[model samples]
Target: MTKTEQFSKLLREMEECGEDEQKQKIEEMKELINEMNTDDFRHVFTKEQFNKFEKMIEEKKISLENAALLLKHVGYCKKLKNIWIDGLKESLLNKRLELIIIAEDEKKKDEKNENLLIDLCECYISLSRGFPPELLSICVPHLLKKALMKGKNEEIQKEVEIVLLALSNIDHYGVNQALYLDEIKEIIQHHQEHHNLTQLAYQSAWLFLSYRLFFNDKSFKEVVANELHFVREAKRELVELTRQVDWMKKEENRGKKEEKELYIFFGWFSSIGNFLINCDLWNEEFAGLICSITRLLRVAKDNYRDIRRWFISILKTAAQKGAAKVDDLLKGGAVEAVLEEILQPAIDGMTEEDCFIFFLNISERLNEKEEDEKEEEERKAAKMEIFEKLEKEGYEDAIFSFHEKLPKAVFHPSFMFVPKNLSDYLMHL
Candidate 1:
């Protein structure tokens, strides 16, 4: 028989095989497909034939191994890969493939189908960059549903990650249209109910939402206001995560679990902070959030260096919420907490840039307060109080000492506009 006939016979045999013979037939099909070159394979399987196999796979008439083998073969041929992706998009749009499958046999079907979904998701992700908007329109909702589905199987978990990663790459406008704020809120709420799923849900939510903010100016402010409820939920989650971190810190045998939890907490906190800053969505509640984060700075001192760095970065970003906001942060004692860390006699693990940025924020806030204050006496008194506080913390000595240790690059001419005294000190260093 010719190659086409042989392949057709193999498929028939595979379909006819009983449970005991299915595995062997799947292996034979995979081996035969592996032996064919792209051109010969493409010549044998027309679009009609390809769709037939796809239908068989979707209908559970073929094993996943056979389905994967067919997909792998399609990927090997350039023309076929393009056709396959187009076909997948069409199938998704036509509802031929159910993206949101509600399996009655959850465990059994999940075990059997998880890898299949993962493979399909990976294929979609690989081909999705700069995809036509129509394709994204068809694919994104399915991806979102997959991302929000909770499964304990490793393959299912991987499928979730791939779905989120794929969603992150689609056109932000497409993503926003496909995943509206209300839908996102529902996913967040669903995941929040399960403690273990919260981090993954927040991480996925952040990745998906960030693209919207990054791409659309109009969507930015709208999302900030509309998604405030989700943001508040994230803050609550962060508080719970911080409590976990604090508890883990006291344990003698803290390992990857503790470290992972810390990273997740930071991810949620930083993402929310960034979203707020990016959209200029500052409010009194955010000021309160900054104050709370500042309290955690001293607590993080004895923890990992990364934890300390992340806390400082969060504070630094919070400080950048303009002059009045910075003043609020300072009034909430952010400066003292930050300065205590910066003025340490022995520098341990913190970077010079973090220290400089913290100080620069303080200086800017001081200058801004001076500029905003109409009365000279009030400005002078405010400046004197800040200076006295700094002096009490040995700020002058710390600046001179840290200046000498800083690299010449830190004093680049680009920074010549820094306050004259600070610039002069850096120059002398």
Candidate 2:
């Protein structure tokens, strides 16, 4: 018999049982649920039956509604593991969609049976927990769309929260931003001012929204800028990052879970920095962003070079792309954040290449000859202050190491044969 058919048979056996024997039948059913949970299908099915099960999923012959009714009995879904999940890759993706269809069908029935619908959603959670990141494509839009639709109904908000958790699994394997950016953005916009939506729900939608921003696709830059109204969202996320960074910096909060979450957010936040630079979307309204992000450098351990690289990229973009003025950046403690906090902590190798590039941008701005005599003197003082700090700190060593190459980098003739390494040095510096 098929898994569901076997389950169906067990249900029949339970129905036919006398009241005195009901408990025994129920134990048998629990055994079946365990029987269905296995490292390989063979644990539950004969080899021939297992191959047929795979074929049914691939051929669209499985009834997911009934499948959910079966899997829900296995109970709570947490972060599932690897191994068999990957082994079942091809059909497993189809199986996941089948489960979604069942969940949506249950929602449509709206039978007012909260428990039943919730149990069905658990089936999705159990399966989705082990899903590979790339396989997220087919299910995320549906989940977000369901959350957006169901969030409007206050009575069903609990179920909607559970749905959001399913989407939040993107933390394990991030979604491909290009695939569902628009839909995710719409969900975020919907949640921003929603009345009955819980804070948890709203935050989850924004989380949904951020996964889409965590990638580089030249095509989506304009979409992010225009459609997503990214500037507003960028400031909003900065506020959140400020809170999170502050909370994360506390010594008491240094538990393993917090550390794991911190690194995960760092990876996503790193990509956000990339968007700021690659999208060319920076402007003056983002001045406070530098302050908030620079503060995050305080907690970013210097040995984590790539995260530091991404954070510096944001500062570099802010300095170069006009979102933040050089004077404002200097005044906002950017100089100290870059030099003492990030560079000095990084004792092993050169993490300050971008720092120099950032300083070069600042130097050029400070070099601009002021029309006012008093302003000229103030500008010279700022320049001198930065130069002194760089020398006092070891950034001067980086500068002195660049030596003649620094001049050529600053004033490379367009026609000169800038070697690949030289081009890379200038790019990084």
Candidate 3:
């Protein structure tokens, strides 16, 4: 039977039984689920059906609604909401019910509920030990300070990791909407006090800078500008730690973990390049930051392409935003040398789709510049004018034939090269 049908059958069996029989049915269903070879469909239940099951589990009913809820909850259920609070009182709670609802709090960002789905899965760390475990080992005091400043749930390490990962992934605009400055500032302050947390502080500071640029806010420019020292410090630390990979593994030193070091390095370096360009701090520092980016790309051994893409993006963004400052970087031949030497090689090595995406990045930068120069109202009028002209030529021609010619002059200079074909086509039209 299908997973849902099996689940429905089990729910019917469980509900029809006495207390003793219910245990037997539950055991039998567990065995059945374990035995099922569902390699093609990893989920035992789909998301919608799982939610149905979650609601039914609470009501202890045997209906379509209950079976449906069971399916949804079982499919998507990662953690139970506020289960940590309950674990404090009842130590013998069922492991399955201990699931926390990983749904993003709509009130957290004042956005629509559907706009933010369950962004991450957080396995509950029991709170019965009196208070939430110290996250300092995983997250620095500065990170804790900032994550909690908005009264977010930093008590859970997985949740904090999710937020940090989110901060890294989301666009500048999204981060601004999601995170508060008060939280960011507090986190930076926390990092300032911690000696071993220089990397953490830099990443937080960099993210803050990125968030600022995304929103076009100048207030955090000073904070980002002042962080060049920390960026350098963090980079140095990363190099030192990575160099001692063997020693760290032998000593089992957690501080020298490769993943942590690479991310911290990336977080700070990308931030520095982004901040310098955004804050308009154009000079040797900006040049040095770009060079640092190039260096990272050279030494890149990480499996994650996102990290590499961001590194290149920082260069493109710096060039786009710091257009004024780039005259000097270009004059020294660094710009041409890097692109021809570094970026092109990377592009050539990438998959066809990746090459297309890289081209799109360049195209977007050019398009965005053009877009900024045009008046929004004028563009709308131009669009309407094109439609009107097309209507005069007949709506079908406008839609299929005339629209294709709009960008032919600019996009295809080769149109001039094919003079005979163009003449014949134009004559036919």
Candidate 4:
């Protein structure tokens, strides 16, 4: 018989063999492939035999060891390599090889065979691309462990990040049902403490949180709010990122290249704010988080314009919730920041529009504030304080400035002028 026919017959026999005999036949095949010339070995196995091998592996009739041996011998044949990788993935998806077992196997071979670890990680990533729910239970811990492993080679660390990102792409259902919340939080904390990995870590954390918010899962939300204290951690990260931006700016003044770190921080901060607003967990702590952001605003020199705009957008959303949230924004220094931004001579028109909208919302909340007999005096005093601050900050002048810039006969003709009365003017606008 020809080499191809002989290999085909052997494949049929292997399929019919019991486990022990199958192992022996696999060993025999491996030895045969090892002894054959590379060109001859490529010719010996027909496409049908390769397909049968893949099926056997996926069916759990072949051991991972034998699968790896098959992949190793496939070498640089792109078609065979792809087929082997698909078989490995099929095995994983079919649960023929449990994730923990794969992880353990990867750990054992990590030091001696780094390439295998990468290949395995790639398989996990492929599964994650489908946003498979199984990934949360099976793949996450292993990926996090690999990411957090001490003394991991740089290549391994990079592969771990790629896998983490792939896992982060899991859709809302996958995130809501995810079983490794604490472990994910640990990964976030680990990277938060590491100067270089903070961005990647935060990116991963945001990915998970965004999906949770999308699904509106209360239990998972509580995990982030109470256990992870996501707002607090995000605040800490923002502080670090702000300082880094300042350092970068100074370096630029000294003739170094300008860095885009500030933009990156802004993107993350905006994402956090947007996610938090949708979570419906706004409370005193959430207010305090906004207050902390205002404090950051005070210290920010570069990119303050964009920062103020994005932050005020968040404040506006918070204010719309109720009087209490508006009070939170006022107490958080949001009013002062809005006034400051509105008063800027060169502020963009869109930004001024946003600030004006926020001002109107806050004013409406203040008007609707209930008068409790016991707290009447305190409430009046607080309102008086806010009024005084607005007046002192040129609230009228800012309004006039904005009014003067409006086009004549616009679609919203009411917006063309600032009314004489503050409340009436806001109501009209």
Candidate 2's clash total is 2
Model 1 regions lying over 4 Å from their true place: 1-119, 122-138, 147-182, 189-197, 225-231, 246-256, 321-324, 345-350, 369-385, 411-414, 423-429
Q: What lDDT score is found at residue 406 in candidate 3?
A: 34
lDDT of 2: 0.52
Model 3, span 34-79: residue lDDT tens: 3443331234434344444445556665433323222222221111
* Prediction 3 global C-alpha lDDT: 0.39
Q: Which candidate is the best by TM-score?
A: 1
lDDT per model vs. reference: 0.55, 0.52, 0.39, 0.55
Report lDDT (Cα) of residue 251, candidate 2.
47
Task: Summarize candidate 4's per-residue lDDT along 127-238 as a digit string, tens digits.
Answer: 3234355445545555556555433456645445454544454545554444566667676656556633535435554565566666656776776666666666666666
- Residue pair clashes in candidate 2: 283-323, 357-429
- Candidate 4's clash total is 0
| Cα TM-score per model | 0.59, 0.50, 0.41, 0.56
- Candidate no. 1 TM-score: 0.59
How does model 2 score by TM-score?
A: 0.50
Q: Report model 4's TM-score to 2 decimal places.
A: 0.56
Candidate 2: segments with Cα more than 4 A from true spot:
1-141, 149-186, 194-229, 236-264, 267-271, 299-310, 316-332, 342-394, 398-429
RMSD of each: 11.7, 10.1, 15.9, 13.5
Give the per-residue Cα lDDT of candidate 3 at 175.
Answer: 33
Candidate 4: misplaced stretches above 4 Å?
Answer: 1-174, 189-199, 247-260, 282-288, 298-305, 322-324, 370-381, 400-429
Q: Candidate order by TM-score, highest to lowest?
A: 1, 4, 2, 3
Candidate 2's residue-wise lDDT over 144-169, tens digit each? Answer: 55665644666677556656645554
Per-residue lDDT of 1-429 in model 1, one digit per residue for the tens? 766677788778777776558667756665665555445565555655656766776677776555654554344232212222334444431233334222311346536565455455445443324555544554555556666677656676655654554454343454544445566656565655653343544565665675566556755555554554434565566666667775426545665466457546655665665565566654555555666666666666664556666767666666553412554565667667767777655555445566666666555544543444455455455556656666664666666565556654553333445544563433222
